[model samples]
Target: MTIATRRAQARALFDAGVAAADPVAATTRALVQSPVPATLIIAVGKAARGMAQAAMAACPNVPCLIVTNDENAAPLAGAQVMAAGHPVPDERGARAADMVIAALEGVGAGDHVLVLVSGGGSALLPAPVQGVSLADKAAMNNLLLASGADIMQMNLVRQQLSRLKGGGLLRIAAPASVTALILSDVMGDDLRAVASGPTAAPLGTKAQACNILQSFDIWEKCPRSVRDHLSGVDTATDIPRADNHLIGANPISLRAMAALVPDAHVIADPIEGDVAAAARVICDAAAPGITLWGGETTVHLRGTGRGGRNQELALRIALEARARGWTAGWVCLQGGTDGRDGPTDAAGGLVDSGTLGRIDNVAALLANNDSYAALEQAGDLLITGATGTNVADLGVLIRP
Candidate 1:
């Protein structure tokens, strides 16, 4: 296969993975099996709009509220769509959190609350606990993001500091019947980790959250209010039980990609951890024909340059391929299913054997943690504006 053909095939496989996690289809199917005549619909995350749209269609006349990032914000006929900052908490998200809490408060015992949860929900709904301010939460968020803490660990800490996380929403909507149809962006499908488990159980106690923060050595840098909240004694009562369902996740998307190429090698274990390490795993498993891997990776922000894990992983893979002297035609595509990586507009990067050759200084760029700019110069940045769904990241490699 020619390099061009391989690149196209890689992207096709990646697209298939994304299609499998379509929030609308997933939500519609979930509701069909177990219909929710909801009085209130609350959707939060990158896929919130689509999930809310699907639920609103199923239960017409229901009051719907969607909380999502600015990129995914759009007017929905029957829902109140609020755009909020993602991957980082902001004042807008704080207001949205208040709105969510207020909506939950208004829900009566007889009312059924259909909660659509997806990736980015944690940051999108920063209901800071009593003493903690929104700026504190945002600062903590930046620390976690830059500290290279994995999603789970970061969420464990977030759960302790928020009023609407770690089953806090369930506590708030006590008498109301809450049902969360979750689109799992978490690698292991840990329902609690998805959006910090707003409608699910807490991942662990406040002590554990404190432990994680200290383990990362960022505890000292954390705001005093945050530290106090996590260390404070737990006087809250038990969280009310809710019906939580896993509607979609990364594994499903991986399977979907594998289905497109019957002979493809699907990495059973997700590609996770550091970007360079994850890239090594992908390169090591690159077999002839399509090979697929799915999971989110972490990038330690040592440099001032900008790029997300997916972009860094892609560039790292290209460098790995070059170092390994893989002469045969091959292409690798790594991207976030949400269609945006880090702070950049590009989804991720699609690079081939010749990608390194096209770049002027691959090492300098990688050293600076500027994969987006490097990929841009090489014309390898994969630009797919807001897929309207999030199930972590997906990778596709084609070799001949």
Candidate 2:
């Protein structure tokens, strides 16, 4: 097959993957199939609007509170839709979190709280624990982002810092039958880490937070209030056990993508660490057939270049594949299911053998962390604008 055909096939596979991970269909199916009547629907994250609509369809007239980022905001009938800051929290996020707490308060024995949890929820809802201010939390978040801490580590610290996380939400709605419908964004679908486990269980401790902060070399940099709070935090007791269901995630998307390719093999190890290393590992493991991967990767911003982790990883794969002198007919598409990568308008990047040859300054672009510019110049950037469903990122590699 020609390189063009391979690229087309990869794009087709990505489209299929995204369809499988769409939160609207998954949320409707999960809730409608269960046939549970929820008293209140609390949908949080980038997919909040979509998930909230699905919940309304399933339950038909439930009161809802949809908290999401500005880009993901949409109108919902009879639901309070509040737009908040994302990838970082603000006062609006803090208020929305308080609203969630107030909305859940005073629930009775049989009322069910249908909690829709998805990616970006952690930033969309910011309820700092007592003694710690929102500014402190934001500073720590920026620090963590700069430190290249993945979702798990960032959430481990976030869970400790927030009053609404780590099973705290479940605790607030103690007697109510609260069931969470989670769209997994973090690796391995660890509920405790997703959205810092608002409706799930807590797996982190204050000690762990301290260790993480110290390991990141930010312990001394942390605000005094945050340090004091962590130092004196007690092991929370009597926290309610978590009952959450997965509606969609990266694995689900990967499965749908795999169905399009008979010989597709999904790599078991999650794509993590630096983008170049991940690309090398994926290229090495891939055979003369399609390979599927689902997970989020990190990009430690070396230079002030434009691109998300997906774009950088895609470009890295192209650069590395050329370095290794792979024969032609190889294509890789890496993109976030949510259709937004980092702060850029592009979802990610698509790269092939042709991509490396198109750019004379490929090394410089990689060094400057400017895959966005290079990929855009090559007409290889994937731009799909807020997909209204985030289940981490989906990657497809084709080797012929």
Candidate 3:
């Protein structure tokens, strides 16, 4: 197949993966027989608007509150859409948390509260525990992100420092039934890691949180409130477990992509750790037809490079392909299911045999972590503009 066809096929596969995780369809299917007698729809994360819109369709007059990132914010009738920061907490996100808490507070015994949880929910709902300011929480989050800590580890630390996380929201909404429709972004759909388990119980402890901070050597640099909160004695939060439904996830999207390509094989496990390492794993195993991988990757951000993990991974793959001179006509795509990667507007990057030919300074671009610019120059950047869903990142490798 030609390079153009390979690129189109890769993007088509990705779009299929995203379509499989559509929040509207997923939410509608989930609520078909579920008992949400009276819904105070509280949707949080990147896909909050779409999820909330779906819930509203099911219940026309149901009151809804959408806490989502700015890029994904869309106007929905009968719903209050509040834009919040993701990957980091901010003052606006803090206020959104207050509004979310307020919406959850009044659900009586006869009411049903539906919480649409997706990726970035933790940061989007930045309700710091008493005595912790938004700036303090944001600083701690930056430390966690920079520390190369896994999502679970970072969430463990975040849950300990948040007021509405770690089952805090469920506790306040008690005496009423709560159903959380979740879109899995973290590996294993570990509720504790997905948005810091806002409506779910934390499987970790404050001691673990403290250790992570110290292990990262950011304990001293962390905000005073974070240090104080972690140092304080643990208090038991006895909250009823909200019904968490895994509406969609990375695996779900991966399966969809796999079905689209003949002989496509899916890596059962999602990729993790450093982006370069993950890129190597995919680059070293590009088979004919399709090879699918799903999972989130981390970037150490050494240089002032502007790119997300997916962009970084794709660029690294291109670099590796150039070094090894992998089989001709092989194309690979690496992008987020949420349609936004890191600080750039592009979702990810698509790399082929010809991708690096257009640029002489490929190594420099990769070194500076500026894969977005490099990908754009090659016309390989994947820009889908907010797919209205979050199921982590999905990758496709095509060899023809």
Task: Supply the TM-score for candidate 2.
Answer: 0.95
Superior candidate under lDDT, 1 versus 3: 1
- For all candidates in order, the CA lDDT equals 0.91, 0.86, 0.86
Q: Pick the winner on TM-score between candidates 2 and 3.
A: 3
Q: After superposition, which runs of candidate 3 have C-alpha atoms over 4 Å from their true positions?
A: none
lDDT of 2 by residue, 1-400 (tens): 9888888888888889888877889988997678777898899998899988888888877889999988889788789999988777899999999999998896778888889999899989999988889998999887787677788888988988888888889888878888889998888999888888898766678888899889878899999998998898577545775568988878878888877776788998789887778888988888878889988888777787887899989988887788888888788999998888877888899888898777768779878888888898888998888888888888888887
How much does each candidate deviate from the true structure in C-alpha RMSD?
1.1, 1.8, 1.5
Candidate 3 per-residue lDDT, tens place, 56-149, comes to 8887798899999988898887899999887778888988889888877877888888888999999999888889888888988888877778
lDDT of 1 by residue, 269-363 (tens): 98999999988888788777778899899999888888899999999998888888887688889999999999999999999888888889988
Worst 10 residues of 2 by lDDT: 233-242
Off by over 4 Å in 2: none
With candidate 2 superimposed using the best TM-score fit, by how many Å does residue 381's alpha carbon deviate from the native?
1.2
> What's each prediction's clash count?
0, 0, 1
